[model samples]
Target: MSIPFLAGAVSKLFLQFGCSEVRVEGLPAFVERLKGDRGVLTIANHISVVDEPTMWGVLPISTFYDQRTVRWTLGASDMMFNNTFDSWFFTKGQIIETFRGKGIYQKAIDTARAKLDEGRWIHIFPEGKIKQDTLTELRRFKWGVSRMLMESKGGRGEEAPLIIPIWIKGFEEVMNEEREFPRFLPRTGKKVTVIIGEPINDAIEPLLAEYQRKFPHPWVPITYGRDVQEDLKEEPPQLAEMRSKIAEAMRQELMKLGQRVPEVEAREPTKIEWNW
Candidate 1:
């Protein structure tokens, strides 16, 4: 009745070396929901390049044995796929490369959409990049996440993905972007905490319903350089506006969980409370 010893040795190793005290809340529900055959979208605040993997330390080591419980995440092509060795490693890690400036209509997103259609779990750092100022504010989320969230329906009778928001505290101290020399090694003895939200499917369903009501058409993928950079020039006005709103809404949702982070960082986490 036990999971294999080496199931999550990698995350266990990090948990041993990276932080001193680690506390997590609401993960059991997150893990349980993944058992169903529905697309799952999980979003988290990105404090460092390794936050996603590093934060995995909290999951029960046995959780790694079941592919159903794992998540597929997007990685920056420029950094994660810089070389053949790096590309091969990231690919095996269940990460897909997303170009920084490219629009949401790229191959990586297409792959993510395809995976979601297959009922796979897709995690995204909607901020699109690492933000060192997580204690003060979270940068605005990019539209790519919204595109994945809304267009996932594809008018194919596939159910929309279940949405989950997570907030992590303390990765910034482990891998400070400004650290000098021996950058590859993570700083030790830091305190870390993770809070997972229950499914916010109800809140997102309204937006998806509104989006579907407005579009009522199949999605077609396209990309134009500057236009993509600007307000998705090729997209319909309603679409462009809605994507921005959905991304912002997710950001705000995580912000609700973030209220406890500052207190945690100051060594005083309050009685945990979140309003979904």
Candidate 2:
């Protein structure tokens, strides 16, 4: 499975499905910053299932070529090979599956390391799940990304992969969840935008750690229209603080990059959502 072939296939599929006019920013500068280095990690905000494909479609081909030797480690749950076509596409993309509590952490790290050594890139969504709510903003980020960066650098030293933070917008309503696909009337298709922010090098950790020290005291835990209380109970104090800070930092950064949609204020969890 050739990477270029799969990238084209995925890019074509998104283009066919009304993903027109992808607006990409800062790629040229970022590419220049990378300076022929490809072994890197991209951290993104998860808004929809199409995010990965959209990213692939928009990334500069030359940048990918520079990092031609890399593989993207995708979430294990993302491997939904419902048919032969899907399986083929996934393989071609060089996507690797990663999971928790399955002794797969080292595998993901190793895979990323190998790709970096080969002068390629790896991509991951710092936000683990898709946020379907129109009003709800990005959820808090897990510690996995931080942990990965820290550990990778610890072992490799100067060979650590660079961390790039990418903020994307307007991908939530690609397909209407209520009426399913092709059921709703369309006046104008939504516009999708991807904004690539500056990369985070080893220097950013202390700032990140500083922010992590301030999260979660007595403020409201984010409610997602459900009894997510169980999920909230076990959060360690430091971890909870870290997540909150990440969410805040992400929100601020996205807004600065014009990726934040404030017109839609997120709603509290509805009764129906809780029952469900």
Candidate 3:
């Protein structure tokens, strides 16, 4: 096995082994979205540092063998690409090197868009950072997500990539940021629940329609999301509105998904779960 694939397989097993219990709901949506022909944009709330490697364990083991079925994610350069080995590791894991204050139009975002165009799956933490607050209380989403929304394309014209909102609970407990000792090692016996939401087209289509109506040209150029376009001189007022609306809509969807999932508080593998 390739280094990346082997690492992924081990992480998947490690997640299943570490947690006291891990549960997943709405897995069919996850299965269907990835299997679809169009690019997929998965937005999830950030809970812990291990979110990427651990949360992905929800996927079937067979999916790991197919790198395309795995996700290409935007990771903080400082966190994931600081040193030589780490950079190599994260890159092999399909993570794009993203800077924190560099705004959204940098090479990382563009790389992400290109990956999406290839019918790949891109997962993002819309909150843009780890916020281990209440499951229902989510941070305001960054406009980068809006940029991805406006920029990502499916096979057909004007067809946005499938938007799947995911809410992962209990990952934070595996390696709480608050823990001081043995900080790098993942703790065992934690409960985790993964809640996959349905496609959010219905909630976002109206916003997209309004964006098209007002712009009439296209919602392509995002000040915070896309590379610098030639025609873009000054950003219009509506662009900010559109980006904020899209970001907010994503937040709302995730919060609602969290509410629907009672496992967060109960910490039970309530529904049908894929576990060892």
Which residue pairs show backbone clashes in model 2? Answer: 70-120, 225-269
Mind giving the per-residue lDDT tens digits that candidate 1 earns over 100-136?
7777777887788778888988998888778896464
Clashes of 1: 0
Q: Which stretches of candidate 2 lie over 4 Å from their true place?
A: 1-3, 9-20, 33-35, 61-71, 81-89, 100-106, 134-136, 154-160, 182-188, 207-276
Tens digits of per-residue lDDT, candidate 3, 1-276, equal 665557666666776676667777777668767877788888998988888777777676667777678888888888778899999888888888998776666778778877787788889998988887665699999877787666555312377778888888787888787988889988889878888888898888777777766766544444454333332455676777787898898889888888866745465564323433
TM-score of each: 0.86, 0.63, 0.86
* Model 3 stretches astray by more than 4 angstroms: 154-157, 216-233, 263-276
What is the Cα-based TM-score of model 3?
A: 0.86
Name the 10 consecutive residues with the lowest summed lDDT in model 2: 267-276
Clashes of each: 0, 2, 1
**Cα displacement (Å) at residue 95, model 2:** 0.7
